[model samples]
Target: MNRNYLLNDAIISPLGFTTSENLTSIRNSETALKLHRNSRYFKEGYYAGLIDLDWINSKFSRIGNPGKYTKLEKLIILAIKQVIDPSQNFSTRSSGLVLSTTKGNIDLLNNNDFSADRIYLWKMAQVIADFFELKQKPVVVSNACISGALAIKTANDFIESGRFKNAVVAGGDLVSDFVLSGFQSFQAISSKPCRPFSNDREGVSLGEAAAAIFIDQEQSAVGESVHYIDAVTANDANHISGPSRTGEGLYQSISRLFNNSGVDPSKVDYISAHGTATNFNDEMESISFNRAELNYVPVNSFKGYYGHTLGASALLETILTKKCLLNNELLASHNFTESGVSVNLNIIREHKRKELRTALKTASGFGGCNLAMLLQKQSL
Candidate 1:
């Protein structure tokens, strides 16, 4: 099987517009999550990580007409543009595009100017595909919060199967009224910035972000890069909204990946978990990690920094994990002050330097969906 190598990448979020900027902010223990009192989203207000629209328009004007695309489309285009090399001509026939989003242009439903068809997910995918002049039809992944990770897994499968030589995977979501209300109805929105896996942690703080990465079959020769080793997704059919009490699905996903790759669980140096700060999700992850014998691994959640970015969470977190592997640093789990889960975990409470070579990124979403991906630094 052809191995998939991670190439260039980009991130547009409240933290910064580029991947380097985002990583630097994280190294300094900075967070973009804040309290928003906007009545448009919720009458009682909520906490979220949101990008400044004015900044986005100013930056996007240099690339293309901002009026032609929606907010989410602009974010996706800007992210992917940073990954493409203008001097190198890409083969349209051998290239693929995969878009991941739980709600693509869902905010457009309230806008009167756009037609009803503008809200269609497939139509949004077409718009993104046309922007890059990609000849092949794009693949869309929208399986709840696991969409980002699943999209990358889909691209890996494509490259390994010889369906495409390379692929561009992009994901983004906005904290619009539609999204805010849905979570509000579930009483899942936290009153303040989220505190992942902390004793006093509340619920989730919704966030918005756009992230993109280029994956190719060939590895880069210039600097350190990570490659996809194995990935798996499992469903416990536990419930529609709640996770399995015993973490059955997540445990199964991690166990399968390790068993198939023959990689010992101890080899994993760091973990980027889906610690949403909610009682059930965080507790469930603790149970799952203990079951997989990963209790001693250094674990941290990016949600405290970016808030649960829904479809973009997994991909955005993956980019940071790649950076950590190359820089040999371990980022502290922002807002984690005290342990909250039942089983004890090696939670990273402070930023520190370490010799990181392997990482495990996990995500669990609604509909009983769970995903796990193993990544390793390329040996020189």
Candidate 2:
């Protein structure tokens, strides 16, 4: 099987528009989550990570007509554009596009200005595919919060199977009234910025972001290269909204990943967890990590910095993990002060330097779905 190498990437979020900018903000301990008093999202104010519409529109105007696209579409387009090289002649037949999102254009359900067809997930994918002139049909992944990681996994499978030479995987979600109300109804919206793994941690702080990366057999020339070893997904079928109490699904996923890849668990130097900060989710992950004997590894969650970005969480977090490996640094789990879960974990609470090489990026979502992807720094 041909090894998939992660090449160029981009991130458009509340923190910044580019991956470098977002990393700088994280290094400075800056968070995009804020207390929004907007009644449009909820009856009571809630905290979330939201990008400024004006800012994104201004940036999109330089490349394409912002009016022709939805907010999420524009974000994905801008992100994918950054990863694509204008000088390289992309083979339309061999290239693939994978889009990850839980709810694409969900906010447009009641809007009359756009046709109903525009609200379909496939339509959203088509818009992005057309923007890049990708001739092949795009694949869409929407498995709750695990969608982003699963999308990347799908692309990796395609490349490994010799189905495609390369693929562009992009994911994004919006912080809208529809999404906010859903969380609010579950009483999972935090009153303030989230504190992942902290004793005082509340619920999740929703966030919106778009992230994209190019993956192929060839290493990238412009940035630090990383090898996409393998990814595994498991479902415990525990509940509709809650994770497995014993972390069965997550543990299985991690175990399978290491077993198949022939990599020891101890080889994993860092963990970018799907730390939503919700009590059940965080606790389940803690137990899972302990079960997998990853308790001693340094781990951190980007939720405090970007909130739970739903479909974009896994992809966005994975990109940041690549950045951490390249810079040989461990970013502090923002807003984390004390350990909250039952099992002890080496949750990174302070920004520090370390010689990172291998990383395990984990994501668990509703319906007991869990995924773990292994990434290693390529010794260029």
In candidate 2, residue 103 scores what lDDT? 90
Instruction: Go through the candidates in order and give each one's C-alpha lDDT.
Output: 0.89, 0.90
What are the per-residue Cα lDDT tens digits for candidate 1 across 192-289? 89999999998999999999998887765666789988889999789989999999999999999999888999899999999999999999999999
Residue-wise C-alpha lDDT for candidate 2, range 41-104, written one tens digit per residue:
5656778899998899999999998888999999999999888864152466778899999998
User: Where is the poorest 10-residue window by lDDT in model 2?
Assistant: 85-94
The candidate scoring highest on lDDT is 2
RMSD of each: 1.3, 1.4
Candidate 1 is scored at a TM of 0.97
Off by over 4 Å in 1: 40-44, 86-89
Provide the TM-score for each candidate, comma-separated. Answer: 0.97, 0.97
